[model samples]
Target: MASRAPGEPDYQRLAFRYEPMAGRGERRPVIVVGAGPVGLAAAIDLARQGVPVLLIDDDDKLSQGSRAICFAKRTLEIFDRLGCGQRMVEKGVTWNRGKVFVRDEEVYAFDLLPEGGHRRPAFVNLQQYYVEGFLLDCALALPAIDIRWRHRLTGISQDENGVTIEVETPEGTQSLACDWLIAADGARSATRKALGLVSSGRTFRDRFLIADVRMEADFPAERWFWFDPPFHPNRSVLLHQQPDQVWRVDFQLGWEADPIEEQKPEKVMPRLRALLGEAAEFELEWVSVYTFSCLRLDRFRHGRVLFAGDSAHGVSPFGARGANSGIQDAENLAWKLGLVVKGLAPETLLDSYDAERVEAADENILASTRSTDFITPKSEASRDFRDAALDLARDCPFARRLVNSGRLSVPSTYRTSPLTTADRDAFAGPLEPGAPVPDAPIRIGGREGWFLDEVGGAFTLIVFAGQGALPDTDALRPDPLPLDRIVVTPPGQDGDPPLHARAVEDREGLLARRFDAAPGTVYLLRPDQHVCARWRSFDAAAVAAALQRAAGGEIGRC
Candidate 1:
């Protein structure tokens, strides 16, 4: 279902009401709160792992916000793993570059997470409503999914065994119990607030007014940031393209201007005209004025109750990292939860979820806050220096590289995570197995083609072409050493590497391209396409170990 924008809060009924549970209801394994991208993603991931999921939303209706519009490639890869990649790529706009300007002149432009030696999943521009709807559809298709709408959570209590939640429903107040709980609520997350988690960081003094407008501007569909606006000398304007033939424009409103008062079309339309020329004809789709802060939870997990998405960290929306990072938190948590619940991995694995993801979350917050400082500096001298750099970087590639690298949202790696398990028997050196493995060209045995990613091979297997070398397995695993279980292909394969999917290697004998491992190295990739284990040389022992590991598991290996 398509949702209306943030302004049309015709969303019926107050946010909370009282309800009561009178009878004994069945308990679920996992109960997820919030139906937004982060919550929904966690629910869907759990459901896919064969864990029953109960998804709760404050209001029954789909959200209406231009809330999260841009998804980085790593995110797209996760969607692909969930069977929605092609649809997203096909339905959304693909962008490669973005530009920065000062006084109407181009100053800095750069790549968004430069291609990691392969055709990466492109950064897509689609409304948050559409993304959620798509994910909701996927969740419904799963046999174990239960999405509860109009369910407002008022309180929570947890014991070692499970958790109980107090929710106000349309009917009355009630309590729901589950083995695990994930609060994906928002920055003002009731869950985080309830836990009394200490969040650090000050809210920005300057508020940003964002509007989805229809205008005949000649600007390219890529992201455009301004160092200093020509109209508002003290503030800046940000322009980004969106679907539905509309664009999103943001202006700093000096913290004191009221959003409700600014809703007057007469006042808002003229400001939009300030960005696009006066001749540009446009209509407003939605307008919002919100403030952001660089706050983070003192802890992501407190006992059995866990926090995901904005419930965990809140980043300034400069690089479009907030929502994407939250969704990733869901991905990492859901899989580990599945393992622990199924008795596949130890509870120790769960501890790593908070430790690893919090690092990633902190990085996201730091990156976003830095981006915010670059575009909307708080100090007067900093603002002046920022403008001068923009003015001079117009023709300087060196300066452009410096500015552009920061804007591109690169895939966050887990090199420092405690959960990023590296084993010498299965892995060599300091390779982070849980990291998104770089793309490699390889040969498959079945078809008469040389291209990789055949059958959507992003997180699939890689086969060595000739001599059929045995690849030792068990190198890359995040934690608890599943042995054979992982979404990434292990280095060993039963049959000869399919010629169609073999990585083309250089003769001097190193991989010249991204996947260029030495000859006879069969690599297995994870769902996020990270290299798990690779075979320096494959043999019967390596192949047998992989098969043995695959057979002994609650999680199926395909």
Candidate 2:
């Protein structure tokens, strides 16, 4: 059965109940404040790792409009780990290539995922409500998660041990305590406000109108962006296809445009008719005007209260960076917080979440800021530069690289992360320490699968073997921490049985070529599927030491 209709969602207000134990001062393990995609994803990730979580949200309904309609490949892969990727990809509109135009003329085209062997597409256009609904279903099914709707966080304070929060429930105000508090409440975070922390960054003066229209159209399943089109004279426009005969259209209205007036049907219809032609027939499903800013807190962790998603940072919607990066924040924070809460790693391990994610947030901010400036030129000189670049891009290949129709979102690389053990072996291609591992095709036990499927949820050692016995992992795994292994053999190797680690035959040599692998080449991956360390040959001692360092233990080298 479908969750909601194609045009707009029927808002469902979930019931609210008072849990006596929450206010009775019994300390809980983890409490996540917010039920958006980021909060739900965080709660689910922690729960899957055997950590009980209490997820609270101030409101009872899913997000209203088609806000955040784009989900990137990295975000989908993270969803796969959360056990909801298949449903999302099956329901959302998938696309990989997009075209750019200048004054109704095509300037250049780009392909985000030009190569194959990946599980999910480069981008999926689904409404934020659908994303939230799917994630909520996942959270409810996990026995470790307790979701409380209409539980607003009114006050928060933290000490060296844990955080104490005051929540406003249906019955009355209540007090709760937890070992850690995750604030995913969104851009205007009550938790951040209560703590007196501020996010510092720049805010653009331009505005954009989002019109979700329901119509039968022939637009291809691809991103089509225009700079100074004929219909909308000097301004930019963006078009995207969503599931269920709905389309998302974005028109750039200048800073002086009145937000209320622009959202009216009379004002919006003229613009739509101009683009779709006067003869077209359609119904306006949803309409809104928005102004965005790029900002983030100086530190994601304040005492025992941690922040993720919009509560921690926010960016312009141009690049689809806000939600994608926020979900990633949950991924980065979950494993570290899980280890810290379980006492398997020291509390200091949580600090790396700040160090690594802050680096990523800063990178995203820089990219988003640049895209905004290019799309909306602040000065005549800037517009001239952009126009010239667009004109030259039609012919010169080098100028095409300069044309920025909002450089689409991609996963951030944590090259400066403190948890990464610097590369000691010479390597080629882009799979380096602190980089997210790329996926390839493989066959294991007479079944085909992707490379990433065999390498998540724990610290993993991927050993590239060549038609030989599977490498023994007896000495590689350390005490109290389970390390998984995937032994990749040559393409034609037959499946073997009774091995300590799972073995896969590189079905097309894609895995070998992607990882720059050779006989006995070893890669050490963190729980979040990031490469922490690698070597030309499998050295049990080096891999063990690197694994320990990645878990926030003392840094060791071999």
Candidate 3:
């Protein structure tokens, strides 16, 4: 077990420099409130896209405890685009399999990453403080991002053109303005409250006690869930491994249990001892009792003000959806906001962020709610059903699928989004419109790299011209927004030179098999790496129309 250090964060306090905003009459392009993972990620994404960003946080340091510990593959991929994926993966605990138990007997287990070829694993378990610190370092390295510490948003006013905000600093009050404002201030968002927006959802009556402890246990890096175990009869408990030998233990307490009493050392120590035996030696790291609710706002966007992360929506920790979904929200909005700010897309493009993410929130909320219900059955009938499922899961292979400890987070597909270009040709595999671009190993410049690494943070046009002549793209250029082209050719196509600077040889044929690509097939991808459109053959006019639709120019066509 790792020893605890005093004042763990030890981050330096940044000086607040206030300029006369009224006299200069200057308005920044974008202002992001909160310095958490979501806000810092948005700032980095925007800055990487050549947009100046102002990131303000009320706290001078990173998050105190390991608030969010699960980082999904999609979220990690987004972090990769923001320039900190490798650092995070190296520091975090990676795991792919999870086991579920009924009493002392194991019922079912599942592997999240069943397939290979992806650069990232299914998920990484790292403390929130580490993620925030890494994102802050990445943001500071970007010259276009200005991070202000100890600057809190006090008041906000928005008009047709932009937003005006009053910030409270350590020195005094300062006024700042921006064309757009992102509220990542967390669940009890001051920005959301000031905007008079309300979140609507159900709060579960059951409470869970979370305990982080440093113990030199020999448990493998996997999620272990127990229902009605001897140590905690008729209740549920979960355990996960994290970095620095810190283990997170969650015990489900009934509605009648007092939250304050459950967090006390006297009450918590007994439970820990029961789970880890009397002879186990361990140091307590952190403890908290929380009642999770599945809630979200009616709208994520209002005029010039936008919301992301927990401020936009919140879910139970059972599914590990909260932070992962928030990071996805930042990734989804950053590119659209960049295009809008750069005048490459219409203001209506921002509306898709609300549409796509609201749907994603609902999906997450639904999954989390189901998992919560299964874990903590509210009624006798529910309890019977859950027990029956677990009992059947032990013997029947089909019933194993019915067991749900928590449906670990997966990226949502925006199939019905307005920006998705409906497929005109039949495809076999999962590379459909609104789906994230699947990763595959490929050879670029005689170097090995994943497909996603080549087509991120920018609009990409991938043409699968198998050992044939390439199409002329000179006549079909989308203005303002830069479009990068990658030609994927057959294995023995080095004799015929590539039309573009970037060309990848489909060495293993994984790209062709996964995408169901044929000769002359073309795929148009968005900056967020979602497939927007595809065609059996490249048509200049059709591609142009699809690009226009993708940029939120024409309605009803997508």
User: How many clashing pairs does model 3 include?
Assistant: 0
On lDDT, the leading prediction is 3
TM-score against truth, every candidate: 0.81, 0.96, 0.95
Which pairs in model 2 have colliding backbones?
Answer: none
Q: Worst 10-residue stretch by lDDT in candidate 3?
A: 11-20
Rank list by TM-score: 2, 3, 1
Off by over 4 Å in 2: 1-23, 467-470, 495-499, 555-558
Please give the CA lDDT of all the candidate structures.
0.65, 0.87, 0.87
| lDDT score for residue 523 of model 2 | 92
- Candidate 3 matches the true fold with a TM-score of 0.95
Question: How well does model 1 score by local distance difference test?
Answer: 0.65
Which 10-residue window of candidate 2 scores lowest in summed lDDT? 7-16
Model 2, 454-532: lDDT tens per residue? 8778888888887555557676658788788778888888655335678888999998898899987999899999998
Candidate 1: tens digits of C-alpha lDDT, residues 273-323: 777768877888888888889888877777788888888888888877788
